[model samples]
Target chain A: MALTDRCDIFGSVHEKGINRIVRHLMRQRPSLFNYGTAFFLRNPNLLCERIQAAPEVLQAHDPLLSVQDPVPILGAAIPLGLNWCLQFTDLQIDFHPGNVFHLPNELGNLPAQRLALRMRGCFGLDCPSEEFIREILPQVEAEEVAQRGKEVFGTKERQPAAPEREPIVLPTRKLQCLCVELFAVLHFEWGTIPGNPQQWLKLRLDGLEIVDLGPAPLEEMAECYIRAVLKLGILPRLSVPIEAMVLNITELMRKQGLAIGETITLQPTPVPAGVPNNPAVEDDRLKAFINLVVEV
Target chain B: MAHFTLAVSEGTFRRSFDLLKRNLRFSKSDQASFGIFVAGYDVRAHLEGGTLDLRADNTISVRELDIRWDRLRFTLGINIPEICVGGGCINMPWPIPDICLPRVCVFSGNPDISISPDLAAFVAQEVSFTGRVVARYFDASVPPPLPDLCAPIRIEPLPDHNQWHIHIDPQTIDVDLFDFPDIVGNLIENTLSNAVRAIIPGGFVRDIILAIIGGIADFIRFLLDIPDEIDEWLSDLFNVSFGLLDFIGTLVLDFFSTCNPIYRIDDPFELLPASNGLIPVRIPLRNLSVRVNDAEMVAEVDIGG
Candidate 1:
């Protein structure tokens, strides 16, 4: 989710609150939520069942959501898993897990209005009793967390020492699967990219990426290109051609609206080798795809 | 000099073997069973997949068998799986730690429990072994003149078992109704002929001569326990000299005028009655396939390569 939405939904926890949480989690988990991670399994407030119901929720005439509305309530269901199913309340949940994030392409419209089909290992949720976590939390609880906070500051052994284990600070995440906070807004509109004149363009912001479906109207006789994303419950074992994924993203954007006048300069990420550049090489092998985006 | 009569067709021959295999149970009364294992008195697990080294002072009979042929598929895609025949002698030597150590000290005579031994004389017989060959027709393209289930030839145990021999009796076949002896004889002859041709082509030109030469090669190779590497090497040179003899034999079979002015060389039955004049090549020719009538053993046999 976008930082603002993440902050609001996480109870007005602004960038400062997030920084504090991250620092605390890092102190607890170490390096994981810090720079060591290439991916982050966010468990932020969502349920597996609700994620499954999201497609129907949107098709039922989506309600216009304000910038502050919780993402799952705004006709867009942010995918989450059951394991690491943390909850401030029954409604507020977190699916983030040990140090990992998905690739932007793998996000598969989880931030879009559709079913949250997973393309990775199922964050299998056994839902350990809250009583269990609470019981384990107090066992051998220590005082004073020897961390940078104490060493950097002059406050020596004062009052009740912070638990020996630092108040958890998530490890530094060097990279992310999706644009975690790259975008500014969370609304969508159909527009036109001048280059692709005949196709209607779709531009959406989940406060992370400015997702654009290319300007395309199949033919004068065809219906609007209907696209949906689904998540599988397991980590997908797929060998994908990055080139195909890139082409797919570009094509989707072109159809939505080649209407954006400004050039969208995208960075070139390295594509793994042996994945055939030709999509047709594996056109029918959808099972091999760990995650997928279907556009009808 | 001797003719033997034994009647068992290929189908009956195979069925008998199968029934015997299924019925034969390992006998506990067999002394070779528990002799050597008790002697080990200090091995954990026992009786696993390994060789049994049978050694004696005067002589050592060792079989470093690395395999059981149950999984080995034959060229004909037939498999007569390996079944434990029986060959272990377990003997425990007494005296050891009275407790756990001694119990473990005794060789694990169980098949599931593995036992390791450096040198065991009366090595506990775990499982016995038997050799088998999956018999399949060489060629199926040609329609069988008679029902294949009733193979004219039956398994006849040879009187002189040490030399290792099998009798191919085709007399039981219907000479008129089916005319299968001709085909059976041809299969045997052609198989021999091919073996000769493979050994030294142009050496055995005529079928009869080829059969004679092939038989000699078989006796020298298999019956006498000669290595094929040496047999093959000798055959190349041996065939040249034998080739001259083969040519002369063919001439005799064709001209000797003992049975008739001329006899058809098409079927083996044709050569049967003419055994009277086979005085010269008789001993050798019959080695490939022979018919001898003596008071004790009246038989027609082939010493297989």
Candidate 2:
């Protein structure tokens, strides 16, 4: 029951070949793997201080949670300082019989094929102290209060507010290094993407496992975050458009002045294990089967 | 081991061969003179019906491939010897002197009679060959040399590619001589006899002249210098005198080698298409080789950076 037994054509890319592609893509397109947010700090010390020092900690009004707001939180204009950043580099990939990262028992037991990825980077978050928040909040509230009064009274004349405070410089620690390793099982499905009529051989992330996260709860959270990133941000890039794989014999014949009105398409065929050259994740090779179909 | 390898099953190879066969065509016209008698042929033939075998020894064996004649016209030129009658000097008395009678000649001189008859439907040829599939890399950057215009026959041009050309390198080729039916001999004899008879007198005179000629068929066979079996003679006329066999062999060789390739693969194989203004991803191919097993023809290639 090997993959070749059920398929008319079979192909495989070895681990070395895969690694070569990964290296080229990672170097040329670094932005694909790196992400960061200014508010979400990677440094736990600063993040804790910002949360504890806030004045309205218990009754804080989150713009995101407001249902009846005039402007949506995403579209609303908000002024924020850039204080945190995360960047991943030195990304590496490996096919199963895992080498770079170990697969957990749950992931290892899965019947699906899998691959592991290891990446290392650094991130940092900066949060203002209690004194700085107290000083900044009142000035911001006073300016807002004056702006509201003018709008309520229907005044056309300009109104002068209190003098602006000088910019304050806060001391912060350097970014801390972080290493992440993840294992994901692979799944193959045939479907079409929205807005595109052509079919595609899609490679989907069946499952995700974050390796060595130290604690169970933290590992669970990290797994969820990484899964979302991989599923939404990365897997789509790997989906192969079936139209690209078609042999296009009709067009070639037309070029040669042959009027055979038949087209040959290279379609992926199902493969079962134990077949010679079976399409599977084994011996560090990702193999698949393809067959040619003629359409008139 | 290469980064990528593709194996085409024998069934698939046969499909490609069939396509090539469908498009294959060969037509030639040539004339040659053997002493006083001249022979010529205009032939148009095509390939059909062959058993394609992929051998484990890494060669392809094509057996009994029929070369079907679409149009085959054989032309023969025979120079009739002088035929004369009633020519002699009448003996006269010495004093009266000799008086001579004029010679009555059937023809003014040696006349060359030409006969062009279509023998295509009656004749056929079979060819067998064994060859290995060889892969040749074509570099598109370099221009190909100009063709030899002065040559008797010009070979078809090949693509100066960025392509992997798969050609059949023939090791051995066997082409059968053109086989003619027994009726072909009679057909030619009758045509020549009628042509000769047309110029002679009719009725009693014609019969006497034909009898003197000693059977028009025998007369023609003697003039053409042919054996008793007209079919065998005709076969030799076309095969050896006309050099049709040699022409066919060379044509077959050129057809399989340079004129057409069994398969072609682009050198820089495109794996992904350009999208959203991004350049297409292409991998360079190198060291492409082909081998045939009992079940399939395997082509192996290495990926270049």
Candidate 3:
């Protein structure tokens, strides 16, 4: 389908659409102090096809919130997994990055809101208990995330003697389908050159490089333009012209006895070659950042 | 005395083998401290399109391995615009070989693995690994698969069974200068004179061919043996090591330690009294063996008291 056709379908979700969903959610839940219209719509391109309810929508709507407020609130709802994209977008939220907002009545009341709150916490929250969190987030664990983060992004100074949280014990079968996605945006900087300088852009997964796009002229240095679609599944496919490298990782996962819900942190970096491996030099020549997104 | 034995079926073995074959991919690298260039070149080889079999005779073999590299090559520093398309280093005159490899096949005897006292940990059996080099040249005019290059090179695995270690002894590896087809040899001799091949005494093209073939074999050995290294490390770390004097002292100490046991359990021949007001028991270990079959590995222990 054409791009506009897809947008229109989502655009026609309602006369008010996502905006209305967000305002209604705000009026219903007072704990959800902040949210946006786009928050509920992931793959804005697929806007109408898959409309997700926001976390606040899943929370208990305090009728008091609507009555206590002087101004009328709008409506919107985002699905649980939608929180993953928040780190990449300009949309703002009051909560800290990677923190899951849960219902205060999560454990006490055990209502339908508990399931919604649990699902949200499963994907994004670093909640305290595993038994409660595992109900919705079957594939990933917060402790594992923290441990993996320390191992991948840790420095000697940053390394801790022990983990601050308890490690989640995982069964063998679920560990077999471990998958992780790494998203990186590399900014290129040329020294005094006006036009796009030629350089190789390399993306290495787990220290092994799967693709290198370069020797081609770069368009601009002002923005981070390079993005990678990491394909980690039973049958691994690295799309082309990069398709020359056809790798199937399912066997390796089995050999390592990886569980289905296990997380594999892919620490990949993209850089212009031949540059000195100095911090000062690299800071000037290029800057790279990464986000690790995982699923069961 | 007590003894036990276990058996495995061919079906289980095949299932395990298929699972292993499916998982043989180089998804990511364990070495990251290395630079991007090094890491990028560390490509993985998989039997993407191939057939394998495991026999009931306790043997596993791969009939074919259609290897394709996991990464595409693009010029890093070169600025020639003619070769640049969509910013990829293509259409270039220079041979920018894929760091890992291109498409190829392994046509050889069925390779097998066996566990025996006479062999080092693991070694390739009955298989003479031979590769068909398939390098894609951008220009159609360039005739592919030079005549002399058609010969399949030999890949040998020399095992150090006595030392309990195996090494890819490519030190004696050689390439026959006359083996190259005359046309192929002449082109390579002249073309490589100006490049990195210029440093080698013989034909540079010939050396590169040897290197590629040897490198592939070496990589296979690495893939097979890397897991063993972890076990070896663990065993070395835990297995006690002692100097000559320490060993003798320990032996004497153990002898003394065993003599003062409080009680004893004897065979029909004799009965001993408790010395330290506690009964001592002696259990005889008659035998221990690890037997591996097509489906399972059984560890049997025979004990007698």
Candidate 4:
């Protein structure tokens, strides 16, 4: 092993003895030994040496040699000369035992469920308490704005002093037929009849009475009920006929000269009864979770 | 004085942080009642290159943040039988290349790092990051520029351990794309207004007026193209930034919140030797201050609390 280590075959593997034997074999039997001599002359060890010399080719095969993936190699080779902020003498932070609030061991295994739901074009408002104002109203407003944009480009109220008396209007045709579904889930913790928990909820859209799913029964023990249905009078029908109907309505009001680019609002409102004037959301025992969704 | 402080090198942090990679995929199928049907959606993002650096003044810098998306693919079906609009589903897939946000630097600028001792944790100072974020939709040649992001991280220490557990509160990363409407409108007006007028061939005053109004409609439609699913996806994707800010911000908090034991000193409760042959002592740590250098930080504290 020591002799093998000392005898270094640096670049070309064609040693003196090996080269002499290969030449003698080729000369003795020209046709038969020519291929064998050539194979021996083009040694695999020499090929390896050549590959080691050409780093780009080697890197193409082995990502460890490539610059794009140098983390594995550089991480081991280079030290991370991190200059810390604190000195060796003053690195300690005061550990105040009183700072930590230890929870009871019984509560450690409390079942906490986690759910991730991805909803599209649905506005959800969640608050620690009911006192937190309608936080999801802004989302509703944004939805309203998006619906309004679909109707027209925008109203351009030209100045009175300008040559044109009327504003520049860009009118758009609504989708031929469409139906929207409004869904809501209510979780009532209390304030309802225990045997038969029933409640009335009303929903309105675009100044049109959508639906009032009269009275729905709730489950027991923090009862949760899901109530979903088509909007009230505007059933799933041909939107072309609906458009013509709207046009007839517009014709009746034509004397007023229904201006172009006028916005048609689609506002959604939910009213759930059986709660105090202002439900105290902070009271965990008397809490309710209401989630509203509008699918168009 | 009972004190202990530990110093973790940048290499040590990198070695410890080598296990944060996973495949993320999402698919959703929605058939809306409003003449819109999406058969299926496949969104994939593969995180490739990642490197971390612990900077001075409690800052963590990531040099390479590359995310390669397989494709933003979906099949859209619009069902409106009336007005010659029949119901049919077409495969609409987006071919988006990789997005690399290089050298994303995040640091705590605010000096007020609030500590909730009751929770055994500290709310990291409002962490801010500098990185160029872009959100491009299918068929959109140019993506929208994202605003800078800033947020806070809650960092807590683990008992009997030298490391601190860092949690990213996603609610804190605030990036608003409310100006998208304004941007789209401006783009349409600038690029289309003159072109529309040129094509209309109207020299008369009345004709010119008609041309202007007609052109605005075309511009609005082009601007509001792909409003439903693709627009929402781009907006949501950009809004989250692949949780890069959250991940890197947590690293910064972890580095800053680490209570390493550099030196451990015993604390004697009393001034004299105790009856059990133990000295009663206390280490008074006082006058704590931290100063930042270009690439280094120097902290000084007295032996008195």
Candidate 5:
């Protein structure tokens, strides 16, 4: 109906991300009507969490079984941010905390694939006792709901905490366990691509310029960092109402030829070990790099 | 004018390219390949010089030049249309190197004016290509090198909603990871080095370290942290330690690419993201995307009298 435009709403139903909230308000009479007008006024943060968790509440359709979730909102937020990047001619965002992740209120970058997102530990603001979790939990689908929450959050808890990242020799805290001297770390560069049937994963932890909290399993320690970075952090997603033009620094590096072909990539020599045999990459020729760099 | 003719498809850009790809040794900077043919010329005369030209200029322009004595020659080139001033075949290696080269000169008028005393040379060139190049002559004349029929860059492209995911082969990974000793050594060395010397001032380090160690034990992680290359750093610091040259030389043939696979992407506009999780997408560029940078190459030889 409108003239040709540079922007388009993805669909009518998902209007700039407010439809879901509108539906939530319709169900529970405005806190002004039921809980008391003053109740909604008491806690602004609580009110926001409720509004954000509306879609989760409406879809599950079980009020007595109420729970607060921040995952999908985080996921949705990612696409929205990425869309913002798309609208710009040059979008440059550093791979830093808050800029790229939404961590739990506390704890980050844990090694486990299943994580809890809340101010307190495992459960959200109001968690059932361990006893209740044990009794009513196994009987129902809370685990399933919990998992859905995890994917939305785009990260998991750090199980097994401090991962002995390397066969390190201890400097201070010595673990008699055969864990060599090392630091615990988790690489956030993990991603799943669509249409890849084989579903193979190439693990890389190099080039992060990672911080060392000292000798532990890097996988576990990395979680702490991820959590730190992702805490209430912005999740990377693809959304519209804006644009989805995420300027991946890595891809840019690849474009600038900073992403050199791995020696194995070229030779495909097939290291019996499987890691691409990366011959030392000559740093980008200063001349070539300078010529193409308008602004990085 | 001496002329040679080579047949190509009606619009045979790909075929002509395939022929070049199959026939030469690669050069890095200019992305060209060089191959040679003596051409029924009498090399028996050593008193005069000769010129190298693509008699078939309308059809083929020289991309690489190979000039050598009895038998020491190096050449690899390509014919990128942007740089081809097709009619400049006045002399072999003309307007180039500005030296007495072993090549025959072609004068739109008379051919003998340009002269050199000790020269015997050959001419070779290539052309631009499209589609799947079906190589007709990649012979043993070139040294054995790695092959990549499928391009690897542009493996991960994020188009609107859909993304290009370059998948790695797990089997290939497992075999490659466990088999290479240097890689394993690198891992073990880094791990071992990292395992030691961590100071936990108070419970912070101890607790965090223990927790991190637990996570690593639980998560099954792989991290390769090679210390920053200090050779250049050290060299820079010392200045005399080869850093002064700051020279990074690559082989005549180099593979400056990675393992990520390349494919096209479709904009999976999110409005109707798969409720069932199956989304439809189209590969934008059905054909592969490859980048080869071979511009101009220079060889240096100084004779001081």
Candidate 6:
């Protein structure tokens, strides 16, 4: 048989085992996936006027801003703010049935594998509100008019007084069952961590697809954001340090007082094809093959 | 299929076996006094030149592993019979005074001649056996029992923890009897003769003493109670009388099975080292088993969660 058909050392972990590991990562390292960003409105007049005519703009809705406070915009003089944050809690990962993680058949195509990850969690998002923008429109308009007056007449002018507006505090709207299905081709890299020569195995995001994100524009934006986070933030931390896997049999023997010169070096080898229950193609397990080299 | 599997080719296994053999050392001394003669030996031997064959039947055949004796000092002590003459008085010529002779002795008393000939590099034996590879689990939690002083071979127990010990369990051992060369018998005889000659007078007196004791070789042989072939006799003396054969066989068995394990793997085998305050990842090994084939030896194990 070919070397690719057999291995000196073989090891595999079941899908259940992978799920357990995922759960552990989620519990111990939650900061990897939970993040937020804010957007400040440059002009609040446009949105403020629209909210004032329609009070229902402040109500909770999907794919749109959800207002925490539904109070009417008494005066359009308050400055408006828009910010969004996503916090995921109780996150769980599932490798959908019949869709297993597996290595490509060709060795040249190695380091790349196909996998699908379906993540479900309690997702919370702090979205932009129309009422807050409407409340701050009058102040923004007065400031703009004064700026124009200064440019044309070159004189200081007093603006009309307006009622003070309370600062809008948008509450995070939480969804109990927010599901994200990711179909991606993952590539693996084996190298030492920078500044530390310990061997590590890391998986990189090569290609990604968001199965459903409503429309084309939304899907594209979601895919770009998720891909960036996975590539730059989460994937790098998913390394498995394998320095300990290279067992020094000679050293162990010497420690036991057996004087021997031969050393057993185990290095990761390509997972052989056509093996029964191949870890890569088999959805049930994740497996690895190692080549053993005895050095004198 | 097991969670983990490891296959070691025959060539690799031989390398490991050679290392183990090189590190193994056996040194022991014993003595026994049996009425007329006393015999003892202080020996040190090492294993070398073994043919290790992995068989298709899942057994290992070890043949001709020479037990090379580095030091083989055989000590013998024998009490020689005393020789005295000329002590009685003789009457002659009717009433003329009797003539009396003073006693002459070959030795002051019955001497016990002890001889330790240079028996250093000639004694050797071959040990052969067929065995199956077996694994034993050592549990560190339980306290070990007290040592058995009366056991055939006593091994000092070392503290072991949760480890899988792989041993070659011999089914039967066939150890060749120690074979001494003809020169060894001559060496012993010459030493004994020299020791006796050193204690006795030379010239006519020595001749007279020789005549009285019959041939010196005969006398020594009679004292040792051995047949004509001294080398065969000496071989028997070591192999049977002194129980060296049984001792060697038992020693080999105990050495491989109890004193040392061919291979050992610690339970909860550490796969990663602890760094940055994180605990090392260790996977517990379970149901470990080993088997031998014509091409290789294989070990299969499961990982405990």
> Which candidate ranks first by TM-score, i.e. highest?
2
lDDT of 5 by residue, B69-179 (tens): 232233322322232223332334745653443444333322212222322222211111111111111222454335542244334332334333322111100011121
Q: TM-scores across all candidates?
A: 0.16, 0.52, 0.18, 0.18, 0.18, 0.46
DockQ of 3: 0.01
Cα lDDT of model 5 by residue, A1-296, tens digit = 21001111111111112222222332322221122112223332332123332343335432311222212212221211100000001111112122223333223543322211111111112222456435543534554666668768866563345443222111111111111112122222223556643322232322222223245576457655654454334333321111122223335446655432221011111122322221111111000000011121
- Supply candidate 5's per-residue lDDT for A224: 56
> By DockQ thresholds, what CAPRI class is model 4?
incorrect
**After best superposition, candidate 5 residue A9: deviation in angstroms?**
39
Error of 3 at A67 (Å): 71
TM-score between model 6 and native = 0.46
In terms of lDDT, model 2 sits at 0.59
- Residue B219, candidate 1: Cα error in Å is 28
In order, the TM-score of chain B in each prediction is 0.16, 0.46, 0.26, 0.27, 0.14, 0.48
Per-model CA lDDT versus the true structure: 0.26, 0.59, 0.27, 0.28, 0.25, 0.55
Evaluated at residue A197, the lDDT of candidate 5 is 36
Q: How many residue pairs clash in each candidate?
A: 120, 5, 32, 19, 115, 4
* lDDT at residue A49 of model 1 (Cα atoms): 18
lDDT of 1 by residue, B122-223 (tens): 122222121111111212245544554324332231122122122121110000112132223334555777776676657425666776755665454343
Q: Which ten residues in a row have the lowest lDDT in candidate 4 chain A?
A: A83-92
The number of the candidate with the highest lDDT is 2
Model 1 whole-model lDDT (C-alpha atoms) = 0.26
- Give a tens-digit lDDT track for model 2, residues B185-282: 33565565576589864787777765655465445534443332343244333432223554467456755465467788887766655444334445
Per-residue alpha-carbon lDDT of candidate 4 for residues B1-305, written as tens digits (9 for 90 to 100): 11111123344335333422232232333433333322434444444345655444244444333333344444444443323233344444567544433443233222112221221011111122222111111112333234312112212222231211222222112222222332344455545656656776666764666567557754664465344224324433454333454545545543333322222222211223323322222223333333322232223333322
Tell me the tens digit of each residue's lDDT in model 2 across A1-296: 32233445557666666555554443333334334432232333442212221122123321111011111122111232434444554555566666644556767643536655555544444555667667666756776787678788977355665365433333344333445555667656667899998877677787777667768999898888878888898888888886676667667777877665456556655333324333466656677666756665
Candidate 6 colliding pairs, count: 4
Residue B6, model 4: lDDT of 17
